[model samples]
Target: MKTLGVIAGREMRLALRNRSILITAAIFAIWFPVMSAFGVVAGAGGDAATIAGGIAAITIPVGIFMGYIFCADAFLREKRDGTIETLLCTPVSLRRLWEGKAIGVAVPAYVMTLISATVTIAAISTIAGITVVTEPLLLLHLATIVPVWIVASAGLIGAAQLALGMRENQILGFLLIFGFIFIIIGLQEVAPGGPGISPVTEGILAVAGIALVAFARFTAGRVTRERIVLTIP
Candidate 1:
């Protein structure tokens, strides 16, 4: 646990120090929520469900974006610089290292998710002149499903970055960014009626998020030092 904490702390510090990345992430985290809030108010008149849906639409993607940007520094940069090889020589196992790094990235990403949610709620409240109170299910989604998805994404991306060559990571990164763009566009299309967050839908999302996390953990476990080293370059 101590080792994990140390590793997580180190990654957090590294992430913070990268001012360009930090600024870019901050912009996305703030901008998307504010825009989504406006669109919700304009189209849906800021009903609770609409506000919740708007916030939900932006929050998950912002969290994923944060994880995507940070994972490059947390996972790939280390490999590229050959620092990861030295870390691999330590007593800590690869899985723990992956967990620590994923947690580190996910923490900040989740914070950004919270920020996006807050911004959305505040914008909706202001624009529609009504207090924003989300549904219980939406609250549950923010508290549980969102964070799990962020962790899952970071863990899975980190595992892939560690296991793949530089060329592959670059290609994967491009695909991830474009995939996020498409997801946001798709959400925009469905967001007009607001997401029908029935209990069943919530359950399915929760289950899917948990399964993704488990899959990421399994992928990380399969990553060996030799594979990581061989892939480096």
Candidate 2:
């Protein structure tokens, strides 16, 4: 438990220091929300559910999506620089390391996601000339569902980075981006000529998120230092 916390803390500090991570965080935290609000502006104005859905559609994905955007190199970079070997020699178990790194990547991104969601809601409501009130389902999604998604996403992707080769990891990163993009587009389009994710949709999101968490745990059990080291370039 202490080892996991230490690794998570170390990764958080490293993420804060990384120029690319900061830049990416800034872009999504500042620009993506405004852009999404604009994209869905027509239906979002003065509708709580629409507003909440639009906000979730954009902001919820920020944490999980950006988790990989930043952690695509979680193990790949370590391997490239010969640090994976050092980590392998450490007393930390592979599963613990995987969980720690996932939490490390997910935590900061989750904070940024919260900030982005708040900013988007405020900006969108102000633009629409109305009070912003999130629907219960949407609010739940932002507060609970999104964070779960982030954990699941980061855990799975981080584990894969350790288990897969560099080329495979790169390919996985691309696939994740594309898949999220598709989900975003689909959610926006399916919101009934508006911006809200319905209760039913949010339910689906919750189920899917839980499933992903289970999948990540399954993947974590399969990660081994030998395979990670053998595949290192």
Model 2 CA lDDT for position 23: 83
lDDT of 1: 0.80
lDDT of 2 by residue, 99-163 (tens): 88888888888888888888787778767765555367767877887888888878877787877
In candidate 2 the C-alpha lDDT for residue 12 amounts to: 87
**Which residue runs does candidate 2 get wrong by more than 4 Å?**
180-195
How many collisions between residues are there in candidate 2?
0
Candidate 1 weakest ten by summed lDDT: 185-194
User: Candidate 1, which segments miss by more than 4 Å at Cα?
Assistant: 177-194
State each candidate's clash count.
0, 0
lDDT per residue as tens, model 1, 84-176: 999999999999999999998888778877877877778778888876554786788789878987898899889999999999998997676
RMSD of each: 3.0, 2.6
TM-score of each: 0.88, 0.88
